[model samples]
Target: MSNDRVGFSQPQPEPDRQALGERLKEAREYMGLKQEDVAKVLGIPRSALSNIEAGVRKVDAIELARLAKLYQRPVAWFTGEDPEATSEVAKEVAHVARAAATLSQQDRQELARFANFLKSRAKAKATPDGR
Candidate 1:
């Protein structure tokens, strides 16, 4: 029964729990979700979520799935398996979101309207007659 015997399987390497925890924390913050809110949605105590973010506790598959859904990100991103997840565009989006968080409600609404206007203009340009 010794593992050293031939035909025995080697032990698998452990996942990087701390790095996963950091990604989870960053995603949660980017989504503007408080730990308590996420914990409640996951049917767990806030302390448990805190421990998970602190890398003191492991996240089960179900919790990870729920978190990915809530964060609107793929599980592969959290696991550091998505190579394009940290692209420049994503970083710029994050920066915009953080800056928008500091804006007044009226200014935020204006920003949203401007974004819609830009989208409309882009669509018009893509069309043949520029409607």
Candidate 2:
């Protein structure tokens, strides 16, 4: 997803796979873990662990959750999918408001639509039962 969709004020593109991989690696390293340690915790091989960090292998949702637990971080921390992503997009909105002196009617309508969509998604994710 683009930064615009997520509320990035700068409105840049989303962080790419390499950036994600680096983030994952950094998180793991910060925990003082070896690749093999993580792999063992996930019951996967060390090579598979390397593959995941390299972004050659796509981690499933379960593995993502497991990784989050293993690293003692929220899943959003792992995916970079957080309120900050939305905040980044929001910053751009304020800039647009200031520069344009007013949001055009059409842009305001579009913003309303997108914001509603964002709200529903947040609701879905925030359900108590882990739906």
Error of 1 at 56 (Å): 2.8
CA lDDT of each prediction against the hidden true structure: 0.87, 0.71
Clashes of each: 0, 7
In candidate 2, the residue pairs with backbone N, CA or C atoms under 3 Å apart (3 or more residues apart, or in different chains) clash, namely 7-88, 7-89, 7-90, 8-88, 8-89, 9-88, 9-92
lDDT of 1 at 45: 95
Q: Estimate each model's TM-score.
A: 0.69, 0.50
lDDT for predicted candidate 2 compared with the true structure: 0.71
Question: Model 1: which residue pairs collide?
Answer: none
List where candidate 1 sits over 4 angstroms from the true fold. 1-15, 104-131
Provide the lDDT at 75 for model 2. 79
Give one digit per residue, the lDDT tens place, for model 2 in 43-131: 99998778677766678888888888887667785677775743766468546545443567788788778888988888889998645
Every model's Cα RMSD, please? Answer: 7.5, 18.6
Error of 1 at 21 (Å): 0.7
